[model samples]
Target chain A: MIKTYLGIDVGSISTKGVLITENREIIAHAYLRTQGQPIEAIKNLIKELFKDNKNIEIKGVGTTGSARRLAGVIVGADVIKNEIITHAVAATYFYPETRTIIEIGGQDSKIILLKDSVPVDFAMNTVCAAGTGSFLEHQAIRLGIPIEEFGDYALRAKKAATIAGRCTVFAESDMIHKTQLGIPIEEIIRGLCEAIVRNYLGTVAKGKDIQPLILFQGGVAANIGVKTAFERALGIEVIVPQHFLIMGAIGAAFIAQDYTQKTKSTKFIGENLLDINFKTKTFECRDCTNFCEVIETYKNTQIIDRYGDRCGKWSEKLPNII
Target chain B: MKVAFPYLGYDTIALKKFVELLGAESCLGPPLTARTLSLGTKYSPELICLPFKITLGNFIEALEAGADTLLMAAGARKCRFGYYHYLQENILKKIDNRHCFYAISQYTPYEFFFKKMPQIFGVTPQKVIYATWLLLHYSALIDYFRKLIRLTRAYNFYDAQKKELEALRIIENVSSFKEVQKAKKELRKIFSPIINTSNEIIRIGLVGEIYLMLEPFANYEIEKELGKLGVLVVSKRSLYRHLKHLLKLDLFDLRTISNAYKYLKDSPGGEAIKTVGEAHIFAKKNIDGIIHIYPFTCMPENIAYEALQKLARDYEIPILSISIDEHTSKTGLLTRLEAFVEVVKRKKFKG
Candidate 1:
């Protein structure tokens, strides 16, 4: 059987999983909406991946994204890394000369500066949604356009309208006002695409070096209008990698491949996890004044993981893993 | 008189002891909590800094707890902290007219020790002098314990936390100078065993507003959070160091001040000078990063934030500036801290 690595990226808005051979060739992949339920999404993703690549023997597994810790526990990942490191590693793997990475995910955006195939500097948006894919999705729905076609509308604009990019509230109101002024729909869409690019540059990528060989990845990279806007704003061509949407998952697979090679074993629980009944329960721990909200995941009524306790009163009870 | 003071981190115990030594019942406001912050925010101007709001809450709680007299530190060279007492007194008097409030200037220690304190407590100058000396010693003990806790918490968090609680209990029970000396030895004994000299830890410098630097509650126990991330925190601002600097007993580091001149030629009031100066120093010392914290609506620290950002770029040192207020969530703060620790670790690895 060919050795393979599995990578799962469970983000707030979506869950993506990828299966790769030892040669770093993609064997199978699945993407599904998390819809606020990461465990269910991961299960579905795993089942989908297994349906296509049943013969491949999983040697290692890794997880990344906001819900990485939760995904790692469910999958028994050999490596659990943050999105910043995983994205950087995957970008370098695909484009070795990549100097900068611009990632606009569902709810957040980040800019990574790399030197010699290693991330030297990085910054993420702090409590801002003006420059993310979700913001554009929301605008698309409000304008009665499918999010998938929002970029095509932007590309057809005769002249891009200018919208405030500093805040989502301001930008939305400005977009509405421009529409009321009878600005063309295509122009308004293009304006929003530019606004997102401008906001991302002004906030997340602010004061950082944005050099050549810049790769834009994540959910927002599918928007050709935003891609063009980024190119126009920076006066440099921004390349969106082939596996743009699944780059985080691919990066995680690379990490798992490296880790399992060194350890000579994997902690992966295998495709049987698809059939396991995983339940999550959350309660506020009032033992201390902090009143931390503790989340516990149980597999078939057996507690497998506990987290979110600041004092570690609950998490410390479980055997350490990941 | 039943005297009380605002809780300023661990130094509250020392202040409480000082009040008790002056032949008065020491009533500290309830330890800062969510209730205190809410109470403070309710009565404070929406645009004022966090320290003002929290201290206002402390005075209100103390008065409600039947404390007849409230002692609040009064003035500084630059910053709205100087006017905090004046505004708090007005606000408290408006809320209730039964309590007596005194504004003790932190900058004028001699006048405060010999004149203001003696008059308020109706004590002799000699007794006041002795109490002040004892307060200084207690402050030093607390500062030493803070440093020790920061160091040990990085390696063994629970043990350091337990030891810190024990140290606080010792500090609270000490009355005489002899007891203070004994308490110091006992604290050393409690903390000595937890010292693990591991060279594999990252060192971070914390700088910003005096209140945020000294008060864990205000900054969401950031030093402890960093410690949990295996970071050795070196904070230059503390109540003990502030007291020494105010008294002119501690020699000013001219080198740090000169380093600040490269970024900020003059003090912009508050702790801006120290914030910038310390960032330069931390960069020179090759520290992992600097976490700059200040209250929302703080002008001096806002200026310092800009200078620190420039310094961060120039030296390639990562700096995380956190503006805290009543609405600052613990999870949000922790996320930023985790991301920052990752960044610092990656930078260290590359270097």
Candidate 2:
């Protein structure tokens, strides 16, 4: 029997899962759209990753991302960590000499500056979604270009046209105006890519050291156009890891491996939980002026988890696995 | 006469007591809610700072509650705070012309105690002095209560919260200087059972604009949330200290200015010097991290942010600077804080 661990990353836009061995070798991986339903996506993700690998003895489990706590409770994870540390851990693990990390996901863009394999500083895009995968996708759809082929158009342009990128509303109007002025489609696409790179540097990566050995990952790493723009802007080479999309899941598996080594046991319920009747209910808690909307998760008629209260009056009822 | 002032977190009670003792009925604005922010935003300029909008909301609510007079603290230089009252009053006048509006200008002790407050309240100068003195002492006592609660919360959060309310009740009704010290001692006793010292706790210092630091509604009750996360938050910026600084009696403020001089040569604007100063002090204390919070679009805090980057580099400590506004989402804020705390915790354990 193969001794393996499970890692699940349920982000805002996508869900990714991986099964890895004791030596940190990925045996199986799956990626699927969360589609605003993280629990369903996670269950389907587990089903896909575990295909024909039933003989594998899962030793541990971990979860990360925006819905990390929900994923943790569903899968009974051995380790639950945020995406920042998880991404940093996986990046530094693969590239020991990495100095900076530029991660642009579906809705969030973050720059993590590392010194000697430790995250010395980090900043994320706050109050702005002007430059992100979702914005790029929205623009792509409006321009009649598939997101997968959007980067190819940018590479084909001879000279990029200028477009406003400080805000999505301005960027959209600029793109429409350029199109109305009969500008080449490729040049406008390239300009949008450059605009995103400029916006990221001006806001999220502002004042941070952008040294060499930079690794650019997250869902947006697939865009060769963005990679080129980053290189052009920073005057430094950017490298995307082989598993850029699943790096966060891999990190979770690595963290779970580290955790179970100490605890000597895994909290993973089993290899398959698709058959379990999982349900979640939410209600507004009016106990205080801060009217928190509390969430309760149930499994087969038994309450498993409750959270989302600021006062912890409901969350603390069930002691955490930690 | 019925009097009202904008809320300043837990110091509202202290202010209430001050007004009541001045031979007037104290009418507090409604507790800050979503409606307060909405009302303020609706009546305010598009680009005004958050304090203005919130204070305007407080005044509006207080007026609705039959408050006859509204007092706002004024007088600042190199900052927009000094201009909030002038704009707010104009908006309020358009809303309703009958209510009395006043800006109690700072940096004028003689005019404040001898002329302004006495004339407003129909009180003697000696009475005003006594009331102001009690206000200072009440805040000092409340600040002490907060310190004990923070220490206790880091170790025992639930108990700290339970005892905090009980202790505040004992604190709010203290009528004399004799009661102040006795009340503080009682607060200590109430929280003593939960105040366990542990080297394992995470220490974070909070520094930012004075309004955001004092108003829980403005910054979203950051101290309590951090404490619940088992973080020992050290925030020294309070009304108690501000009063001392105004009186030219705070030796600590003198040291803060010198420390701030290491990075900022001169004040760029509001709270910039103090924010940089407090952050530098926190880094020197070798805490786990420093959380810098200020309203979005604040100029001085923005200037201080640049200095803090260098400070973070020099000290090699994690600094989380959060720019808050009405639109700042709760989930997004919580996510950042949790991630930061986890990173800081790992750094400590790994070292």
Candidate 3:
């Protein structure tokens, strides 16, 4: 019987899952909107993936993304990884020679530099949204172009109108001014795409020495206009992999595979985790100078995980509780 | 008279020469140890930066080692560092280690060598200056040779530096700037091409708390250790750069000077901000890495670190945050440094 490893990446906007077989082939995958409840989103994902095959046993599970710890606790993940490592693993797996990863999601953008499939330098933007998917989505709404039509409209434009892209505020104002000039919608869309690439280069990708074999992923990978815009700005080919949107999930699955192979024991909590009633509680522990606010996760009166403590005061108490 | 300096991050290999020139019996507190940290924490304010605590610890340890006179570097400028001498002096007085203190103030090092130290200790300025000059010459010679060797080739330059500096510290009868310059020339000529190579290096700037930056043991021999990986490190206390900034702050009123200057105009504390601001410029020039060193309780650096993080974010430069205290492990800092350098190297390769 072929055992599959499950990987879950829960972002603020989306939840992604990938089931990889023993040989690292994608057996089943799911990409769904998170809609704010990560636990419910993951549960729905699990249900959807298992609907067709109930006999497929999950040998290992890994979680990544912003809500990784939460998702880890929810799905009984065997390993947890950060965005940089997870993304780099997946990108390296896809493009073995990938030297750079330019990932632009809805809320954030990250630039990971790799040398021979290993990550060496990396930077991420958490403050601004000028070069991310949300910026394009907002513009698509303003232009009355269906979000799905954004890339095609940009491809139709012959020229791009110069627009300020320092931030969403400046970009929006510039877009309105360009629109008032009666510029063609396609040109404006093209300009927006170009502006996004320009903003990313000038800001988050600034000072970094970017090399070839670049892999651009994230939800925005669906936008061909952005891809074209990046190529024009960088003067290099940008490769968007087939599993761009679910790369993080794929990376998580890869990590799980690596971990499970190293440690023969399966620490998975089994599918019964789906039926477990999990609850959370928060309290302040002022035992030291650092008054840490610790949160405890309970599975029907039994504590399972503890976090949010600056010191390990509360979490240290968990083993005894368990 | 026996004199001692608290080994904060300043290149003590250089200071040892200065001490020899003064004909002073000198000893450095062991490269900031856990015991030193405990002593400092026991006596100092909890909120004060870790560097200050470690320094106070070093001072106490030196005093216990029978040091009667301490060479305290005094700065009366904008940053809290300006008050370090006064605060330390007062605290030491309270602790009653009232041994005599010789201050290296805003006055030139020559003034201290020729007049101030002699006036305070009743030694002839000429003899003291002569001895001091010889010590400084050899010290500078050692430093020049070490830097030359380290910068040029791929070898354990630290061992070479320590060996050369140790040799320089033994020479006597050095006086006057010209003699020191001559000694440097001789040392450089002998070590030139041999020290200078084909090493693909990324020069990194280590800026932040004095303790973590100076003590390789505290930060786990970070700079020298990184050198093992073919990375060149530029710390804030470099003589040429620190002097240039100090002179600019004094002679010409430059716009966008260090914020510490606002508080400690003619003091060591002011140099803290100047050093940080200078580092930002180095980062702009695209230094491979900038590790902002700070102690767990450092207030000024906390403010500076926050601002620097934003700058790094906007500039898209990689920065590793290293916060050290008594509880810090060498292994932990090493892990982060390796991870950070690895990331930076990877980025550069891709670029």
Candidate 4:
């Protein structure tokens, strides 16, 4: 009887899932576009993960990423952790000696500092969208190139063009200006990678203590040119783990395994939970003048979890989800 | 007048030393009790820092306790601390406590206190020298204590050093810089043997408007309080810092200077650059946390806030944002401060 653990990462742009066996082998994994429907995406993820592993008994379930709460409610996730914790845990579990983590996703960029397999500090770029994968994707479409070929084109460049990468506004204008100057496409692509790396250095990693033994994970890790740019900028090699894109899901599974082993009870609502109805609503709280925007999760008529209240006034009314 | 001075910058010793020098008795509010927070919260509107609420609560308590004058420090430039005296005066008037608010002007209406020779215990020069000496001692003590707290690995050992330093507040004879220096040296010597002086604890740079940083009543005195929880704070005299910023604004072109560059985009003041430079320095130092404070509706700080967040991300340090205004409450501010401190501590210990 191969014992398995389920992990789900429900993010704004994508929902990812992974099923791991007792030996920490990824038995099943699935990636699906969330399309602004986390509930549906998670249901689809669970459906795909359970497609082949009919005999595999799930010991526990974990959820991570931005929409962890919503995923938790939908998937009956036993462990709900933040992306920073989940990513660091996964990186450390695999590499063991990972020090810095450079995670650039479609919508966000994060720099996680770790010492001895534990997260020391982390910085996430939520306000600025300039150095993220979506920014590169937008630029790639504008440059008449597929996003996948971006890395190869960048590597082929003999000389780099200077692209203003401070903000999207500045970058667009500067990119157009550089194009007007008749820079080669390869040079421009290389310049884009450099600009991203430079922007990341100037913003996300500004005051952070970025030591060596860095791990680059996320959708953007597939880009060799960006990886090269990071290596050049930091003068250090970045290790991209085998399961870089699904590391969050893997980390969640690992956590689930660890947690369920101790609790000895499967809190998972089971795969049949896909049929449950759920909705998320956000409202501004007028309590105490902070006006905290509280996000509420409802299962039909019953409220499952309410968060985003900075003072924990509204969250206090809900169950201890943490 | 049996004046009551809410401890803002520095610590109990700084207030004690000042009270001792003034030859005037002070109605010392209890050690930032929960009651103090409630008072602020009850009276304060939302959206202001916790420190402001607590201070107002302390003021209300002091007035009820028969204290007439509330000694405070004022500033100038874009930092909202400059308007503290003016705003507080109005708030108090509306509350109708009728207590005379005698602020020790650090900048705004700077001439009103120094040049006009405001009376203190019927002695002008004596008050001036006394205030100056106390300020110097407080500045030195804060710098040393924050460093000490950060460097020490053993929590007990750090507490021991703090206890020794705090014990000096009861002494009423720090009338000169010589006395202040003596007190500081003795305290440092007591801490030298105990604190892990070798370990450089993560030094955080708190760059923003001054009011929310210095006035515990405004930002919940988070810096010093964080020190109690083993996080060392680095902050200069709020008034002095803002004054230098004002001089730079007058001297440099509003558009060219980096310190006030943010202000240049909207207005022509050098305060924005001053804030940016400070944020840059903090980032460059690779400080563990950069807790930025700003007053609500403060345009210059808002500009700096945008730039600082970017810097925080780039520097890889934890940054906490705090906005203070007339409506801010003490409890709300304290909760944020607690969370911020907890995050920093968790990160430090885990790392």
Candidate 5:
């Protein structure tokens, strides 16, 4: 049987899965919208990733993203990490000289500065959603342009119209105002792209040294418009990796490979997790005045996992908490 | 009379002992929770710093717990913290007028420890002096307790947490000055087993506003979180140090100011100068990284944030400044912290 590692990233907006060979090669990959249902999304993505390979034995599993804990529990992952570390691992692995990484996900934008393949510093956009995938998706819908074609229209612009991008509310109003001014729709779209790049650099990437060999990953990298804007603004080439959308999955796989090789064991429950009925429920714990909202993940009838309780009264119970 | 003051996480024990020795029953506001924060937020002016809101909530809870005298530390000319007690008293009077509101001026060490406390507690100045002495010693004990907890937790968290609970019990039961020393010994004994097999541990310096530094709830138990991530947090800001600073007996003051002069020419009020100074010290000591946390929109800390960037560049150390508000989500904070730990560890391993 061929040895392989499984990596899953369950984000707020999307869920991604990837299978890698012992030599760190992509064997299979899948991406699907989470749509507020992470469990189902992971299961569906799992089915798609593992369906094409039958002889491969999963040696280890890893999970990352906002829903990393839930994904870890679901897959019995050997390695669970935040997106920042995972993203950096993948970027530096692909581009060893990568000095900076620009990652714009569904609701957050992050700028990670690396020196000699190690992350030196980083920053995430705080309390702002002005320059993320969701914002771009919203503007695309408002302009009656499919997000897939949004970049091509941006490419069509001869001269981009100026649009405010400091705040989402302001950006929306400015976009509407530009539409009323009869500026070409393509120019308006291009302007929106530049505005996003401008805001991202000003806020998330502020004061961060943007050197050569920068890689832009996450969901927003699919937009060539933003990529082009970044290149023009920074006067540096931005490389979008072959598996840019699934770079986090790739990184998780690398981490899992490192962990399982050290421990010589795999906790991965297998890719047939679809047969299990998984559900999660949250209840307010009134044990103390804190009133922490305790969450429990159930496998069929038995409660398999619990969290969110600060005092760990519910979470510390091992195996079957109930 | 039952006395109450704002809670300062585990440091509450020392505060309680200080009040009790002064001949008044101590009633600290119930451990900070969402309910207290919400109650405090309801009456506070929009855009006020988080410390103000949380302390107001503590006072409300204290009054509800039958505390007859509310003692709040007051100061303002250097920072907005001075006006906190004034505003809090005005708001608390509307909620309950039966309790007396006393804004203890913090800068006046002699007046506060000898005159004010003696007058309030109907005790001799000599008794008040002893209580003040105990307060300093007890605060230092807790400060040492925090360090032990961080070191032990970073060494091995699974066994270290239970020892922490037992250690807190030991710290709380110390009533005499000698017992404070005994408690410290017991704490080291409780943690020594777990910390025995300790290996390479990454160290991060935590320096920011004094209130944020001392209060675990205010900073969301950041020291504990970093310790759990296998990072030994070297945070020097403590209530013991603050008291020393207030009394003009702090020996570390000269170095902090000289360091501040490297990045800043003058103080911008509050602990902004101190923040830069501490970050400078942490950098020179070769800390893996530095985490700076203060309330969002805090003027003094914001100035410190700028000086910190230049310091980070000069020292080539990663400094993360987190501006916290009521809306700061726990999940977001964890993600930032976890990523930061990875960054620092990676940097250290490379070197």
Candidate 6:
């Protein structure tokens, strides 16, 4: 039987999963909108992956992204990691000489500086979505353009107009003002792309050394316009990996592979778990002033996992099952 | 007289005990909560630093709780903290005419011990001297336990938390100097089992504004968050060390102040000088990184932050400077901490 590893990255805006072989070849993958229901997204993702490969034996499983803890419990993952570590591992795996990794996802963006294939420094945007993928998507919709064609519009611009990128609200207003002055849509799009790159470099990557072999990955990397903006700003070619959208998931899978090889066993429940009825309910625990929102997961009306409590009052009770 | 003071993390208990020992009924305001912050912000000047607002709220709450006498620590430095007591007293007087306010100047330890405390509480100088000694020992015990908690929580989260609660209970119950010594021995026993001596643990130094460094609520319990991330935290600012410096008994403070000379030629008021000095010390000690936290709109720590940035660049160590306000979210702070820990760990691995 061929051994395979599974990785799931359940983010706020999207859920991504990948299935890989022993030789790190991705056999099947799925990307779906989370839409506030991560359990359903993971179920559909696993079903889609299973449909592509029949004879593969699941060796190990891992989960990453914002909802990694919830996804880890649902999938019984062997390794649960954060997005920063997973992204760094995945970036280094593909591009061994990658010195800096710039990841702009749906709600957040981060810059990870690496030395000798090891991450030496990193910074994440704090409570700001000024230059993230979601911001670009919003601008594309406002311009009545599909997000997929955003890059093409930028590429067609004769000269990129300068827009204030310090604040999201300011940038949006500036874009509207430029449009009112009869600026071309392509130039406006190019300006927005450049604004994003400028915001990212000034805010997230500030004061950090940016060396050669820079890799850009995340959901936003599909936009070649932003890639070109980054290249133009840094005066160095920016390489976007083949699995840009699913690099976090792929990195999680690699982590699972490493973990299971040492432990010699897999904690994955089974491929047949797609049929299980999983439901999540949340309630505010007012035991203290923190008022932590506790989330409980039930499988067929039986409590399987409980989490999200700052104090492990409810979660610690069912340690046997989790 | 029923005396009250603002809560400064678990150090409030030590202060409470000191006041009680001085023959005054120590009525501490309710442990600082969101309600306290809201009450503070509602009445305080909007532009003032967070410590002023929160402590003002604490005084108001204590006054409402029928405590007639309020003791506020007065900052005599060039920072705005020097005026916090004057403003807080004026505000509290408007709420109640019968309330008594005492501002203990930090610069004049002799006046605080020999004259001001005696005049306010009607205690003899001999008794005041003994009480001050006991207060010093109590604060030291609390500081020592805080260090132990920071270290133990990194390796064993649940056990460390349990032990911390137990230690706090023991410290709070101590009524005399001998009891303080007993509590210290008991804390060592409680913390020893959970302490793991792993060389792989990342060590981070914490510096910045005194109140934010000492009060977990002000900085959203950053030390606890770092501890949970398996990082050994060494925080230099504490009431005990402040007392030691005031009494001219602290050798380390002298070293830290001198170390600041490399970055800052002289003190920038408040704890900024110490902040820069400690960052230099941590860099020299080969600590992995430094976490600098201060209240929003704080001037002194802001100066320290600029100097820290230069030090970080020169020392080749990462520094995470977090400016906290009432609006700072726990999830956001945790994410920054997690990312910083990952960066430090990776850097350590490369070495």
- For all candidates, the clash counts are 0, 0, 25, 24, 2, 0
List DockQ, one per candidate, in order: 0.34, 0.53, 0.11, 0.09, 0.64, 0.36
lDDT for each candidate structure: 0.86, 0.88, 0.70, 0.70, 0.88, 0.87
Clash-forming residue pairs, model 1: none
Q: Write one digit per residue (lDDT tens) for candidate 3, span A1-322.
A: 5699999998878899998898889988998888888777888888777877677878888988777877887777888776777889899988899989999887778888776787866666633568687778777887788888899999999999998888788888888898899998788888888888888987677667689998999988889999999998889999999999989999988888888888865666777777877777888776653345677777778888896553345665665221
- Better model by TM-score, 2 or 6? 2
Query: Local error of candidate 4 at B109, Å?
Result: 12
Instruction: Point to the candidate with the largest DockQ.
Output: 5
Q: Fraction of true contacts reproduced, model 2? A: 0.31
True contacts kept of 1: 0.08
| Tens digits of per-residue lDDT for model 5, A157-213 | 998999999999999999899899888999988999999999998878776768888
**Pick by TM-score: which candidate is best?**
2
Ranking by lDDT: 2, 5, 6, 1, 3, 4
Q: Could you give candidate 5's per-residue lDDT for residues B115-186 as a string of tens digits?
A: 888889999989988888899999999989888888887888767778777888898899998999898888
**Mind giving the per-residue lDDT tens digits that candidate 3 earns over B1-351?**
777887734356556656655566677645555567788889988777666787788888888877777777666455566667777887787775568765567437667666787876567888776654454345445445546544542344534444444335432333456766765666565455445355466777778765566565466567655765567776544433333443443332252254333333432343345445645666667887787767775566656655665566556677765667666654345435654765677667652
TM-score of each: 0.93, 0.97, 0.57, 0.60, 0.95, 0.91
Q: For candidate 4, lDDT tens digit of each residue in A1-322? A: 6789999988767788999998999989998888888888888888898888899888999998777877887667789877777788889988988989999887778787776676655666633678687788888899888988999999999878988888988888888888888888888888989999999988777656678889999888888889988998899888888888899989899989989999997778886777778888999877554456788888877888887765456876777675
Model 6, span B200-265: residue lDDT tens: 699999999989888887888888778878899987888899889988999998899899998898
- Writing each residue's lDDT as its tens digit, candidate 4 over B225-316 gives 46545565664435333333433433323322454343233432325555666566655665667777776656676777677666655565
Interface RMSD of 6: 2.6
In order, the B-chain TM-scores come to: 0.96, 0.98, 0.74, 0.69, 0.97, 0.97
| Model 5 residue pairs with clashes | B75-B82, B76-B82
lDDT of 1 by residue, B189-299 (tens): 888798787558888899999888888888888988888788889988877788778777766556667889999999999889989998899999999889889988889
All candidates in order of TM-score, best leading: 2, 5, 1, 6, 4, 3
Better of 4 and 6 by TM-score: 6
